[model samples]
Target: MASNIHYQRADYESGLDENSPLITGLTGRKPELKSRDGTASAMATFGLGFSIMWAQALIRWFASPTEFQPAPILGPDVIEPWRLVSLRIFEALSVGVLLAHIWYCVLVPAFPYLRNFKATDEPHQFTLDGRHVLGGLVALCADGFLNCHQYIFMWNANSINRGVWAKFLPFHNHLSSSRYGESLLWGPPMYVYFCAGFGILGCNMAKPLRKRFPDLSNAGIFTIIWCIEFVMDFVIENLAIRITHGYGYAKTYRPLTLFPEQVHQFPIYESVFVASLGLVFTAMRLKAYDTGRSPVEAGFEIWHPSLQGTVRTFAVIGFSAGAVLIFYHLPLNWLGVIGDCYADMPSYMKPGPVE
Candidate 1:
């Protein structure tokens, strides 16, 4: 009886009494509780159910079916000596950057005891009331899946290459602009990175292991997420060049087919989706820290005490910008690097001509 009485009193105090208009009025502003308000606002912002409407719109706007150009038949052994050397040099530089990140991020701090380690849990981190990490993941999945489909069409058009899955990569042409002669090297690698790296990162984030490591405090889930994001970009874009082209062991690198304008728009959708996802996670990290959790306690927190909130605010902004810059500039960078290398090569060994 006393328990029931206490419950009734609490209900009244929280504005849940039968006569309280706050309880029934849909638009009235009631005294907001953190959990309730946060949950409501998050759902409003990134509701899983709500995204479907927009997803369909994006599909309609972007996924235009188009014919592709046929690929030229060429053998790897036919590649000139100087062009081969240039590609090797570029590969070495990429490998160096990736190796450095692994040593610093994975080996240096996490070695020996393997301290602060955890996979990211999407359901726990991205619930309607939780971090909404899943919303970001869905965006990535959508961007990746659609881009892959588009590439599939590109691969199909080339009589030289097999169907989508049969070729190592499809839509290799859409990676960079055809503005300069540099399109040869830049076009394919970029999308390969998007397809392969993001594919792994997305898969890792959605893994069951990530779910088991629910508490962010015990491990650096955010760092893991960031690293995965970076590496996948390299793999899908850079290394994918080798995979499809068959460098080192392969006989040739040739475009299977060219993608039309519509499919090339993947970067726009991917940039938006990933940016939104990162923002939601940053909010969660801040929310956890705001509750007096230390960076150590809030495993996702990446800054020190004095600068936690401020740093995160900036980092989120920087990361969002970085994503845009990457999507915008990487293709350009790849083009320049590839072209400069090509231009520097002897005229007899240029990409368009062979000795």
Candidate 2:
């Protein structure tokens, strides 16, 4: 049976083969019949992220097993009122910085949509290939799973951060950086986001949906994928978090978090974040393509991005991460758990007067 998409004989000279199974119709990259290259190259880039997350988890597990766990009891709330304010500010900044890392990775290759001027610029053509997909996976791990630089100041309970600025967001202050189980939970967000958002939607599932319906256009296909990704992310993550933390219907890990209410709903928040981001980029790219604007076809240009794009990008990422932090600490700011996390440390962990 002839395929709906026009396929071409392999063109060895230019290193393209439209005849291959991976001839994608996603955003950008079009020369009438350019081969999207072997799907093997694209597919191979995935799953490496899951491995990296666990590998880091193992290294931390064996070499620094307890390092991921909470610090010992500290002097009960002796850190002083002013210091807590400072700590909160620093931690928020850290979150924003880390989110920027994630934002750049997934949004850059798809940057054509951020353009205000629709003029032809050959130097900056944005195309999604094997490299961008693989690179995105790595970035998600570094920023989303690993806590960015949360490890920099993680020492012992007594003195986690020696430097003046280190007091805020000490390793013990966060959950994922402390416990093995929590760390595992952190790994899934990015892995699920990339795998479902990009890999499955743009590749594995797009074809079948198109075939069964016959009337589904690329836009129709994308909308279908977007909805599916959001639902799957929400359901899968909630189960994974609940199982890894307790495996039963009890408050096993609720004690692990400073705010149980916020923790329970976090899976829903993250699912929306990832899903919306994927669609935003897709819509932007599609707009550019529809407008008949092409990417830089030649030399590298100045590489300037629009202010609106920068603001909008950060807004989405900021809300995604910031909402969790705010809710997680709202209870902490009031009545904190005695030995829950470093943020709520018991006596002895603080250097001030002993209780």
- The superposed Cα distance between candidate 2 and the true structure at residue 64, in angstroms, equals 13
Tens digits of per-residue lDDT for model 1, 1-355: 6666544344555546666664456435443332133222222333333345335533542342221222332333344455456555555554454444334433534342333455533222111111122222232322222222111112111112211111112233444211112122323333222322343344456344358777654246555655556544434433433333322101111221112122121122223334334433443444443453212122223335565433333333333223433443334333323321111111211122110
Candidate 1 ranges beyond 4 A from true positions = 1-77, 112-355
Per-residue CA lDDT of candidate 2, range 82-101, in tens? Answer: 54444344335434533543
Provide the overall lDDT of each model, using Cα atoms, as 2-decimal numbers.
Answer: 0.32, 0.37
Q: What lDDT score goes with residue 57 in model 1? A: 39
- Given candidate 1, what's the lDDT at residue 295? 26
Off by over 4 Å in 2: 1-129, 141-189, 192-197, 246-263, 278-355
- Which 10 consecutive positions of candidate 1 have the poorest summed lDDT? 248-257
Q: How accurate is candidate 2 locally (lDDT)?
A: 0.37
